[model samples]
Target: MGGHFQGARERPNGPRQRDGECSRGAGRNRQIHRGLCSPSQFSTPRVECTPTRETPIARRCPDAPMRVAGQPQARSTVKSTVFVVVLVFSLIATGADAQRGPDTLGKIKAAKSINVAFSGDSLPFSYVGEGNKPAGYSIDLCQRVIAGIGQAVGEANLKVNWIVGTAAERVQMVATGKADMECANTTMTQTRLKDVDFSNLIFVDGGGFLVTVDAPINRFTDLNGKKIAVIKGTTTEVRLNAAMKARLVNAQVTTINDGSEGIALLTTGAVDAFAGDKIKLIGLAAQAKDPNKFAMLMEDLSYEPYAFALPRGDAAMRLEVNRALTKVYVSGDIEGIFAQWLGKLGRPSGLLAAMYLLNAIPE
Candidate 1:
């Protein structure tokens, strides 16, 4: 009972109890005085003083007497003073508990695990590397994030659970409590906000097409009545449909589970075009059998702002993620990450660079 709250009868206007140990009574009193006082009321005072004269305590037992030293000073007043002191202590204790941060970090520390989700196929963002382990820009960034989380939570050796899945499943995993973080290339969109929360925009990308360099498809309008390969549950899927419809192109969409599948279909002439974010197309092109065979369509159909997704209710996790992103953005580390994974194309324009600098959180 070291961390226990005060008893019921000791709480102001709480229900009368035989021994005043009702926690429900304290809860009711707390609800009533939710904004009535501050959290410091129960703290031990720095100064101490003795009463010069004892007065009769109000609303107390008549038999009780107040004594300052060996001599009796006042009788009834002592009981009232004791009740007031107990009430003040209870209020302060309750407020302190209410202000305490959530134990998410503590839970991770105790369990020695940090679960995360990564897109299994989004190259340069998140994908399998050597030994089939997770790698890519987001994967690297998340490794640093996990390190920061471990340091902050005092779990330096925490085990990591790297869940690999499609982009669609990545968001659902984190949103449904199956994973703590989705270090995938999840775009920050209004629709995703319904079930998931996003950290600040970590990377920016645009929906573009990757077609054979000699193919007839030069822009969005050139793919009329063409077979377009796209990954399901991505902004590129939507953009493909929208652009096709707007340009009066009769496009047949083939939704693949991974980038390699899409590229394979395209290479075999099964699909007339492959649609994805420009950054992803670049990464995929680098891995293709013939890197020089394909080219990204200059016309971007849509913009996708990439971010890390966390569970909706975990505000502390969200804050830490934002802190990490803001740190990299301000420190100009993103340029290095971009260069490492995306080469020169990943560099943002002057406007976006200024935005990142402006929104960076100060330590």
Candidate 2:
């Protein structure tokens, strides 16, 4: 029949006929006289309609839609999967960019100069010397690091701008990018590492009390009910307070601005004792009006490990700084540098010598 039928098949060649043209007959006698007939319309069919490679589904059934229906959920799922993949890649790229951070070496190369923050009062480590220029043990080490930086950037001579400030101020300068490096008697501590990085250990010292010769204090226990002065915002100050509290010493603690001020306070009898790094106190005592009148207690309250402070998270700049420091330690040039500024101290102690030996990294 020419009319549509469900699950129907068509003949290969059939006589043309009008719609619904079929000969009526009894039981098995009915037949299509002159038109296409569906195999499903008869008990014994002549042909079947199965799609194959030679005949696609659309070709076999011309009324079928190109795309199958009722799959909107699947389409949405594919889009969501694609979006997640793209987002993951984007986050990875952002994290990589964040970790690469600022280029400190490139900035130094472009400026052809480096700003070094130093202490103008911490004698022997960093301080104002003859002609009002920065000079000391830490300054000598920083010069070598600067030279190494110059070679790394292909500059023969890089101008160094020495900025004078206190120890705490120097650390802030390096952290804020106002200074390239901080050359001072800055101690490397767990607290300071959060804001700034440090070079390899350059010097080691201990906190002690520097008092007038006539003072009644002979040991930490004698400092009860006495006044003591210490440089403000220094590791020595923090350690001094801790030590006093631990020892139950009821001494009055005062804060001074620098080593010079601490010395003045001790000399003027404003404080019974002055607490500072042992080596620094020696330097201050040696420069006092009456050197013979001052005596440093033969006791160390806290350990101090000194290093040069650099900007935090700058691995390349730190590598160069350490490389230069390692070279100085390896070549035996550190001896001369030490004697130039601290020769009056006799010789480097066993502890200090061990520090130099341990930090001498190989090329």
Error of 1 at 102 (Å): 8.4
Candidate 1, superposed: residue stretches over 4 Å from native: 1-106
Q: What C-alpha lDDT do the candidate models reach, one value each?
A: 0.75, 0.83
The 10-residue segment of model 1 with minimum total lDDT is 28-37
Question: What lDDT tens digits, residue by residue, belong to model 2 across residues 32-142?
Answer: 332333455444644232222121232222333333223444566567668777877998899998887567889999999999999897778898999999989999998
Overall local distance difference test of candidate 2 = 0.83
lDDT of 1 at 5: 40
* Candidate 1 residue lDDT tens string, 245-331: 788889789998889988888888999888998888888888887999988889988988888888775678777777777788778
Q: What is the C-alpha RMSD of each candidate to the true structure, in Å?
A: 15.1, 12.1
lDDT at position 3, candidate 1: 52
Alpha-carbon lDDT of model 1: 0.75
Give the winner by lDDT: 2
